[model samples]
Target: MNTDPKVLIVTSAFGDGHMKVAEAIENSFRRRGISRITTLDLFAVVHPALNELSRRFYLNNTGYTQEFYGLLYTMTSKMRPEQFMGRLIHSMGKRKVQRIINEIQPDIIIHTFPYLAAAELASTTGSRMPLFTVMTDYVVHGRWLHPQTTKYFIASEDMKTTLMSAGVAEEKLVVSGIPIREAFEQTQDREALLRKHGLSGDRQYLLLAAGAYGVLSDISSLIKRVLLQSSFDVIVLCGNNHKLRAATGELFQENPRVHILGYTEEMQELMCIASCLLTKAGGITLTEAMAQALPVIVYRPLPGQEAGNAEWLSGQHLIEIARNEEQLVEQLQRLEHTAYRDEREQHMKVFSRKSASDAIVTEALEAIKLRQPSVPAAKSMLVEGQAKTIHGYY
Candidate 1:
């Protein structure tokens, strides 16, 4: 019998960060020769239609009604996760999570997103499946916390402090940084990458990433102003946003200075060649940029987690928060100064925890070899928890 520890990585596709983090963890495990791995999208598996509907609503909410969305997020952040509403939200994927746990009997259950059903299932049933949570943001909310979580791989010391204040044991919080793909961990030839993209390594190039969903409404105007007001060339990466790519390409077809691209697998290569990154404050993208030590400029992050991430990282001096096009241009101009660029790069040096996935995998493998997890086949039952007041915020 070929025996290997069965691993289950549960993630959600509400944001690209969750799935990306799952991929990083899966790839890291593969690299470490752990082949018995299964990756699951909890929401998609449990409620496909609802998952799709909610994802669209989420995109719309964050893109259009960010204030309302922030209010919701803030309210939920203060929630006692085991309470009624919180438990109701947490119960969404319980049945499916239980089935998977029963089927695989995984030695580990890792979460990239805050799908706490597995943690809940284990807690109520007295099972210890070694649930691991990899928080992809600079900030930690109550959603990512569970008393049953085995370990928390967080993005910074600030998050550690937040968790400590929340009563999470210091030993359980690992400041591993947000886990990124293997591509970032490996070195690439920057000059060759520049040539492949039909660019000379001679001039400064500004990379404008329109986020994973291509939701930046002001991207076109923003680029026009950047091209007009600045001395640097522009390259727009409209990730998975076919509409944005097509529209941007048509608009900038006549302008050789602006290079518009669609979804690309070589984001690391692009980051390697770009002088600086102008993008959303999504946790994964910021983590990816940090891995490359790429100076980042986030233009008015949407409220909620984006705002929280921007606020936390800004204090650390890891990224510049530009409130408007004028401020963005000012930030870009600052990048032209060799001294300022070097300063930003040095800040990243202190923040970037290289190969966070590898770090988690190393610890996990050791733990697995050290002691077999005391877990049994998961069983479905009524989840009981008390209602606790969740602080509401604006």
Candidate 2:
């Protein structure tokens, strides 16, 4: 364990998806023999009150408050680069984060959540350490493209072009796919994975992932609607919402084909047994599903980042958006056809099945090495010595 190369990962629990990606990257680093890793939930430590507010807003009153978040995103989208709320949050969070950074004194700081990208930029100002951001969403957000970022890790080619258009030097971006849990990359036979979980490939599996905060979002209604029209087994994973899970579990108890679980680490296994997913277009879940070649039906994606992810998925043909129960049912019926299944598999082929976590850790190490004075100039070459490796076309 070379304690000299300590890396600090800054994240938040605004959503479980972001933290999951950070955890994946951290695990990847450890797997590659880079053991000096520190992961922090910035909001948890820096401002517990604000974190609680976010939790209540998203988890407790999601239906009523979702529009407010949408309005905020719309406002931020139209506002000038210098006047964004993201900038304000950074200004407010900078001092506390900077103090933490000074104490940790890490060689590199990687951020998976853009909630504090601006704050992180401010924290590392004038410091010798390098700060990089791995964009958690498939779509690009101005908040994630920090002007001072040492490097930008992205999920897709389109994001790179958006960043370049925003004046980010093309050379500094790395396409590392959305960082997913290493479990998604574990080798296992499809039959074995299904049998281990008492699932049958003979019946199509529909996996529903309620968001981390546990806002039901009418997803259970959508699932029930779909179940009424089909014989496929429905497996719903309501992450962290025991009440919602119990309520839904009872609702489906008489129906032998429906299963409900409250927060389990068996998501990858479930994905292997499932053919279709119904969930929010969270970056982490979306990427994991793609890694497993599971086509998805997205429901009520959050306004900014998640909406972007849904749009990307739609463009990729990896998913279809269904904001209402009717639409969700309609899409599921349409996707049940063998033709749609073939198309979905073709779309899944576009995604990289290999572990992005490993790729991210490799790039992180290279980024650190590039920052070292001892590394030769030739070793500093970026992406095969091209001034910019553009893949948005790919």
Candidate 3:
């Protein structure tokens, strides 16, 4: 630990979940009084054009563009290295990173996105700096693995096992659940939470979540069907999708039981008040709902990653998957008759007691403290002077 300790967090904007996880780690350090923290959107800062194109692809064509990503994934997985892709990315970013690292002289570095793995690999070429890769997703992709790296923080035991099967050393892996917003981990008064949202505590409150794009076309129609068939109150969160929000808003507005919100910061509170959740099976949202002990009813999930996530949730009994609106509603209606509530709670206990931020920060701090400069003089000064400074500040 160095006084005025420098910590760098590298992430990408490929998905909101990755950035959210990175920010949660940064927030944890900030809470511990580590103010000298820098967060880099490696894609934006290094390859702006590529980042924009990727963002546009996800927004405009992600639903149909899996083939393109699949090809890239295949290329990387083959050990081809695509030296050209690596060279191009590094050529654009190397000098800038060298300058930034030289100036900051960071004590520890944490990377949250896989593309940045190349950047970390390049940056630590000859340095002894500890680089911890945080796998924001549940599954381990070839993109995130690098042998020279110091360690990895993964989201689940399944992920850890996946890495082990891939031949990654067991000692280098730490099963830290995905770091989520601190607010999600804290307990909130459900009655007060419902009141704040202009919701009724007595009614069955359902939190409906879809990604920012609202990729699932059946979402609005499904919610409508539920409204007509069930007595529960539904709150729909159509993130950034104005068109979907407006359409859903029109349908739910006139009705007293249905509430449609575009986006808001009261997600934790909403989860607290929600008796159940109806949404796509994104890892963070699924885990957050589980953290709140809310049973989940997953609407139709898109193919690929989301489908995999839905499968994982179903296998854990943390959520019920529906092939269509009819089956989804049937599952929800059954919630009243079974111990489904306690079942979800019991299954979620494995992830509920774990703190993503705590595990990350603890490992990061240890790595920073254990680091010794190549020179004896700098090592002694870092141990005595920097350690005192870091303790005082953090």
Models 1 onward score TM values of: 0.90, 0.85, 0.85
For each candidate, the alpha-carbon lDDT, in order, equals 0.79, 0.70, 0.69
lDDT, candidate 3, 157-261, per-residue tens: 898888888778999998877788788888888877777777776788777774433444566677677778876778778766677788777766788888878
> Total clashes, candidate 3?
0
Off by over 4 Å in 3: 61-63, 66-92, 117-124, 210-217, 372-394
To one decimal, what is the Cα RMSD in angstroms of model 1 from the true structure?
6.3
Q: Which candidate has the highest lDDT of all?
A: 1
Q: For each predicted model, how many residue pairs clash, with residues at least 3 apart or on different chains?
A: 0, 0, 0
Clashing pairs in 2: none
Error of 3 at 322 (Å): 2.4
- Model 2: lDDT of residue 248: 82
Q: For model 2, how does the per-residue alpha-carbon lDDT over 327-370 read when each residue is reduced to its tens digit? A: 87777777789898878867876776477777767767776764
lDDT of 2: 0.70
lDDT by residue (1-394, candidate 1, tens digit) is: 1246888888876764787888888888998788888777766767779989878767873455777788889988877667887678778778776775776677888888787888888678877567899998888788888888889999888889989998999989898988888787677899899889899777788888764333445778888888888777898887667778888888889997899887677788888998898877889889888878899998888888998998889988999999888999999899989999999999997878898998998777765654455446655431232111111100
